[model samples]
Target: MSANTEGFKTFWEQLTPERVAHIGEYYTDDAYFRDPFNEVRGLPAIRKIFDHMFVQLHEPRFTILEVVHQGDTAFFVWDFTFRMKSYKPEVVQTIHGSSHVRFASDGRVSYHRDYWDAANELYAKLPVIGALMRWLAKKMA
Candidate 1:
C-alpha cells in the first residue's frame, strides 16, 4: 500500500449518489472515466454517470475487496451491490468488478477504467435475457 492508497480507499467507500459532488476530490477536472456502459471525460460529465446510477438503481453500494498499487496506478476490485426497483422479490444483486486507475501527482485519478464480465454480472442476471444467456453460455462452453 502507498501513502495515499488508504485515502483512496476511504474515498471509494464513502462515495454515494448523494455524495458524488466529492468526485473532484478524487478525480482531476479533466479526468477520464469509463465502464462497460459509458466512456466519458471530464469531472462534470463523469458526475452525470454517477447521478444516473442513482436514478436507475436503489440503494446501490460498493464494497472494496482489495487494492493493488504500483507506481502512480492502482487497481481496486469491488462488489457493487444493489436492488432492482423492478424486481418483485426485491433480491439484492452483486457485480464483481475492478477499476484500473491512474493517479496524478496530486493523488487524484487522471484516468479510470472499469473491467467486468457484463454477460455474467448483468445480462445473465436478468429475468428474460438470463435464460437465453445461460443457454448461450452452455453452447459456447
Candidate 2:
C-alpha cells in the first residue's frame, strides 16, 4: 500500500471527536474539502465539518472498502455508518461514497472531494422529507 493511502485509511478509520482536532496532521493548512453538503478550505473549516458530524450523528464511523492510488492522488471507496441522534437513534444508517484526495509534497492531504447521493442516502431516510424524496424519485423515474 502507498504511504498516503495507509495514512489516510488509518486516520479515517480511527476518527473521533477527539481526533477531529488532529486534522492538521493529515491535511495541509490550506487544504480544500468538499462533499454533498459542504465545501470548505483550510484546516479549521475542515475540522468544524468533522466536529459537526459527531454532534449530529450517533456513533458515526467510516469503513474503507477500496483504495486506488497514482502519483500524488488517491481515491477511496468507503461506507459511512451511523444513526441520527434525534430521530430513530436505534436505526443504523449507511452511506456508500468515494473520496478523491491529492497529497501535498509533505504527504498531507491538499485537496479532498467526496461523492455521495444525499437524496437517496440521507434525505430519503428522514421522517417527513423522506416521503417527499421518494415520491419525487418515483415520479422522475
Candidate 3:
C-alpha cells in the first residue's frame, strides 16, 4: 500500500469517538457519503452518523479484512461487530459491512460510500423481518 493508503487504513482501524470528532484530518469540509439510509454531506454530519452508530451498537469495532487502493481511491473490506442497543442477553446480533473511499488532492476523503447486503447484514437479522427474509432468501437462492 502507498503511504497515503496506509495512512487511511491506520485511521480507519483506529477510529473511535474521540477520533471521529477530529475527522477533519481524514475528510474534507464538504465530503459526501451515501449509504442505505441516508445521503449526508460535510464532516460534521458524517461525524453525527458515526456517533449515533457507535452509541447504538455496544462494543462497536471494525476488523479490516483487506485494503485495496488504486491511485486516489481505496476500498476497505471489513467486518463490524456489535450487540444492538435493544439486544436481549439471550440473543445475538452483529453487523458486518464494508466501505469505499475516494481521496482528494489533500489526502482527505472527498466522497465515501458503503457496500453491504442490507437484507442479509441488517434487516434480515432483525427479530420480525429476519425469519421471513431468511425464508425468501433461501427460496431465491
Candidate that would win on TM-score: 2
Quantify all predictions' global Cα lDDT against the true fold. Answer: 0.88, 0.95, 0.83
Model 2 stretches astray by more than 4 angstroms: none
Q: Give per-residue CA lDDT, model 3, range 51-133, as digits (tens).
A: 99888776677778888899998888888766777756345565567788999999888998988778888887678899999
Q: How many collisions per candidate?
A: 0, 0, 0
**Candidate 2 residue 115 C-alpha distance from true site, Å:** 0.3
Q: How do the predictions measure up, each by TM-score?
A: 0.93, 0.98, 0.89
Q: Please, what are the lDDT tens digits per residue for candidate 1 over residues 1-141?
A: 986677778877777876798889888999999999999999999999998888778888889999999999999999999887767428889999999999999988899999999999989988799999999889999
> Which candidate leads the pack in lDDT?
2
As for candidate 2, its clashing pairs are none
Model 1 ranges off by over 4 Å? none
Can you write out model 2's per-residue Cα lDDT over 1-141, one digit (the tens) per residue? Answer: 788779899999999999999999999999999999999999999999999999999999999999999999999999999999999999999999999999999999999999999999999998899999989989999
- Could you tell me which 10 consecutive residues in candidate 1 have the lowest summed lDDT? 82-91
Candidate 2 weakest lDDT stretch, 10 residues: 1-10
The TM-score obtained by model 1 is: 0.93
